[model samples]
Target: MFTTRPEIAGTFGCVSSTHWIASQVGMAVLERGGNAFDAAAAAGFTLQVAEPHLNGPLGDCPIIVHDAATGAQRVICGQGVAPAALTVEHVRGSLGLELIPGTGLLPAMVPGAFDAWATLLRDGGTWTLGEVLEFAIGYAARGIHYVPRICATVQTMRPLFEAEWPTSAALWLRDGGPQPNRLWANPALADTYRRVVREAEAAGSDRVAQIDAARRAWYGGFVAEAIGRFVAENEVMDASGERHRGVLTAQDMANWRAPVEAPVFLDYGNTRILKCGTWSQGPAMLQTLALLRGFDLGALDPMGERFVHLVVEAMKLAFADREAFYGDPDHVAVPLQTLLSDGYTDARRALIGEEASLEFRPGSPDGIAPRTDYAAAVERARAAHEAAGSGEPTVSRLGASGGDTCHVDVVDRWGNMVSATPSGGWLQSSPAIPELGFCLGTRGQMFWLDETLPNGLRPGRRPRTTLSPAMALRDGVPWMAFGTPGGEQQDQWQPIMLLRMLHHGFNTQQAIDAPAFHTEHWVSSFWPRGARPGKVVLEGRYDLGVAKALQARGHLVEMGGDWTEGRLCAIRREADGQILAGANPRGMQGYAVGR
Candidate 1:
């Protein structure tokens, strides 16, 4: 029932949502004689329109590119930076609120996607933005979809969108922004799209004009400008970038720019990993793999007792470093060298005994920094998770953030490859710049509310992001390029999927469709201050015997219900030059097609 054109040679194969916008974008690039980077960029831009609630053209994207020819790898940091109007004290000042409420002006960054598109184009793109974006513009104007998931999710948040921004509320809510299943359209947004295209054509490579046009529509455009003007004509944004902190003027929108830089790399055995810097847990991926190598996983069989225990131990160690050290490299001193070093991996691996789980609790380590605050940090995380109550958590029970994002993979006929995890959150908090058809991401909540923490809120600094896209190679060729969109689950899922696919000889679909588990069971790895400990959680799908087995062996085994949250889309290039791509069944809206 779930099949597509099988492993064809010289065809552009892509996987994304059921919506034609993403699919059409990929197909368009193929038709235009462009490669996978071009196809992936087009799909990302189109998803912004088709899956606006989840992602946007103005959202942030982290990408991994594999050049099959030179066998070189590159990662692009498409994440945006915080506004100049933010500070550490402001976050610490707001004590009682839950670390900035997960949404609003505070977390919004200068959108980074356009710059990523431009960079991909600059590096090597045969198609123009106008060609790639046509399908998205048409869908925006004509309004062609309403799947069960989107419709249901939208119904729940209709009032929130309307109350925050009337134009979006109108476009989203239909008759005056209050109904659940109402069909809505924004001719205002259609006009904005038209204006952006005309402006892009006229400006000619002064691409800032196109960006300016989108920014104006989202902020000072016909839809949102009146709201901004009435709120505060001269109320400039203050040091706390939180929505309430800034007047969020059109000027603020005009000044933002996305940075494009080379990704940080680590060599693990024959595989080279390209990851975004400390802003996300890209480096930790390599660290986990390094530690896991110390054990003979192949000897234990894929899902057997010994293999599972070793992986769990490696994950615990990786999360230990993740919680204590990883943060925005530009802001904090992340111990990248030590964490990925063979010596560190060897020491951490030595702690794991072959027969039983370690008696030592998670985060039971000496302080890597000056103050000896390790014990205190652990206690806080333990208290918080325990307070939240454990056992069988889902999106609704977790007080779900509107963090739904999209992941897509493209493998071109030319042996080039691309993996991009593009993301944006709820649109209400930071009002959209009307004409832009996109809103700034309120990702600021990723930081600590405490001023003393390493990831304190700051201006011009990029928040420690969760969107990590990655590429894996074997024998200097593109073996797999994959990633997912499950906030805290991103890092945990990455290694598990690799083990299933690489070590176990599973097909792309088999590895992605299989049930999996993660150890970082909480709000974010950055939480739970000083020496608090937790248990290892397994999926309910795993046999009860395995849980009992781990528990008997000195491990805490919590059971997640039978449902899976991580959706991995991947493509494997066979030795015969055919491309095999697969998407997870969990994503009802997902699909993969090639021609």
Candidate 2:
């Protein structure tokens, strides 16, 4: 089988990401003697500037890291928490909204990406703040070629920006008018980074002190002040068809910081998959793996109808559990142990049959009833689809305000590895803060308004975010670091890549380039949250025979464009000190580099 591109190989270091600029920046850091952490931080910051429409500095990130020195793996919880004043009562009673709007100040959470990256650099990296930020600063100041998707997104939101978000219009539009397919510059954002660097440099000559100083400047100083004022004074129109002011304050930004915690691990065969805690949809992947463990996956054709149907059926069950049980562990006690137990997965696996099950069924873990309204969720999805037709592609949806996130995977010569998914704060999500050159993320939209649910909107609770990143280790050694940028499809696309690699011995690029499919049978995490019962969206590259067979099994089949399913990237560290990397060619943006 031919891949779109060659799988890069090297003995030094490797980097892969959604954008070529970010991948190049990571490679440059590696070439400069920095490790994987340093390269990942640099690439993560550069992604904010290179793919601003897909992600920004104010977004959230959930990163998985493996250190060779200690043979320890940890997850940095970069997903921001809801503001202190944001609660179900406040949103439903005071704001008079049924669901959190998908595109405005009301849905903004505390910005976590900047602080999280800084934390990683401070604790694990071997570079200065100024060194890592230099690439992003240069790009924002000198300007970069505007991608056509970005231009089209801006054009779609031009009317909304002109009427609602003038600050965004001023930053993205030229002379208060549309400018497409030209080199675009964000001087304000460049100045913002420069100011942070200047503050860090002034703090001291020590690298750690300088990093701490940069953190202060972001969380306690000018950055926080500007964001607080903007959210407090501005009222912007969101997905609710009305304008509303946000509840986030400067206090929220100051009070919150990203935390380092242990990853939830699942031992599958000889490989152990690591994901973030229940706060993300990561464990859903673990549950799927658990269910599939009962079957001989290698015996089935990798792209056959039986394989697709079995995987889709298992995914539906896991996602159903996601809607019912997953939430912030600090607020709700997730029956994680029971959910991942072999006994439970065996019972769940029994539900799989020859025909597709259109019903949403979440298991009773530990004999506790699940907390979700399947019929209501289905009705909401149907109403939303009727009102807004099927949403656009990843890059064009919401006028590019908020659709997908961005991913970076890095592995250095010394065996240090990091897989980080940086997302949120899209150019179309909210009005850009005039002085900051970025907008707030609308991640809070993932929270349900009903207080009775486990994932109900609450003060200080992390939203059950869809931003899931994955890392796996073989025999207690870091083997692979991989992830994608789809909101809900993050975990769905991962299993295919893993199966191909484990069963058929596919290389990184071959695994990523293989045809993929996902079921939208559960409620979506975005605005107008809806579900498509028995729906299976497959890439057109898949064999037509497989599609027809799936349809015969009662799947509401839909064909996506060839190579339009995922934006996955991966890097692996071999035992012989060699590094391998791969990136998706679907969007014509992702690239992988090594040498």
Candidate 3:
């Protein structure tokens, strides 16, 4: 399944996966004069068939698209919404239980990825849902060309497959064990895909109609009905918001919808930065860049001690603001202008020592407006839960476990581009709805049970999302499109990679191939497992003297082996009409194909 480099002399497209067939489908879109967005949609659809462990057709997507024809930039908020059945009381009730993280059971919301696909087609894409989805259906019905990555992941999670969850077990295992490499397609999944196709076709023969029909089938059509029957048979929560188990009901599915909002754009010096709405940390990336702009960053070598130090220090200041002010900005008055103003960045930058690092602390959320009623509501909910008798903790206060996600970046020959991070959840087998073919995302786990917080559960409220797909336009031309699939790491990686390209003058491949460093709890907003409690993980390739220098400055430094960091894919549109694309060599991919 290894991809050989494709020619990029003229038209081009690149897709990365453990499966080769998926790449070809995307390449076909490019060969047929489809724009980057169209090709991305096709590739994304194909992955559902080729890489089941990573995404389901029903997973979530966060997409950033740049149209060269008009210099218009677009973002599709593919993140799911809280189910109608998800009440403040329900979240409060689950707070202390292991299931509070919204894993392995009825989820807080339905998957919104299919809705994104439908949106893309309705807005800019040319292909029909049938055309884009055919390859996925084909791979699902026929057989997938398997590889080592799939085999490894399947083997790792084998015990979950042996459980009584019929759909999860049947899909991942054969003969009561994990499925091995090179096996033919699973008949159950094949049947599911076939039914999906039939349902869509029945819904409407045209692309838009078919897509809408498919989504209906996923939520309220045959699949949801089947799910209802299963839930009824099992005595789980029914369509009504009553308790067979606890949270989630058929009403939630009927009420689900994705929001379309304008991206928050910031002007830092001459550069224009785009961030996800207040529900995500994308704004902090802008704030960090603003802080760094106030410094003398050009004085140091790109990879030298001074450069990394400045970036990390600036991020700490920005992230402190993140913990304090970032949430649903509509609900919480995030003093974003003040936070990004010259005054704040300058003050934060001045606090940094020239040679020594300092412990990170979150900045005050002082001038920002707080939701007093929301806070009181949470307290009331917590009291009610306490009054009723609570169960063990469901929400893992520990950071979210790595579930599954994939990213793609495409810069067309004409400077059109698309960057997207599509992700899935990690709820175990017993929790997933069989007809959906994927687990519900654990995104709601990001919300706090504290009613005082703006991010607490509310009707029609969006959770704080971690994904931010991005595209860069320079001189009115699409210059760069890039994004990654790391949850919290998503915030840290964007600036580091973008700075490498803009300031260090590293080409796409060089930036991606270069070693990366990440700070743990002491530096990063979200720290990963096994990281020494107060240390940052630096690549071993970094000079020991640099680490010593950092440690001397009061920083705790940890070393990282290969590939424990992050994955990135990027494409740059050169002054000429050529597109230069590079995946991360540190990852399982890093090649551009064109012809």
Model 2: pairs clashing at backbone N, Cα or C within 3 Å: 381-530, 401-428
Sorted on lDDT, best first, the list reads 2, 1, 3
lDDT tens digits by residue: candidate 2, 1-595: 8999999999998999999989999999999999999999999999998888889999999999998888899999999999999988899998788889888899999988998899889888999999999999998999876678887777777877777788888888766433555667899999999999999999989999999998898988899999999999998777777778998999899998899999998998999999999999999999998998888889999989999998999999999999999999988999999999989999999999999999999999999898777777789877765655654332233332455789999998888999999999988888899999999999999999976677888889999999989999988778999999999999999988998898889999999999899988998888878788998999989988899999999999999989888789999888788888999999789999999
Candidate 2 is scored at a TM of: 0.97
Give the Cα lDDT of each candidate.
Answer: 0.61, 0.89, 0.61
Which candidate order results from sorting by TM-score in descending order?
A: 2, 3, 1
Query: Distance from true position, residue 77, model 1, in Å?
Result: 1.6
Residue 489 lDDT in model 3?
72
Tell how far residue 256 is off in model 3, in angstroms: 2.8
User: How many clashes in each candidate?
Assistant: 34, 2, 22
Report the C-alpha displacement of residue 475, candidate 2, in angstroms. Answer: 1.6
Off by over 4 Å in 2: 175-181, 389-401
Query: What would you estimate as the lDDT of candidate 3?
Result: 0.61
Estimate candidate 1's alpha-carbon lDDT, on a 0 to 1 scale: 0.61
- Best candidate (score: TM-score): 2
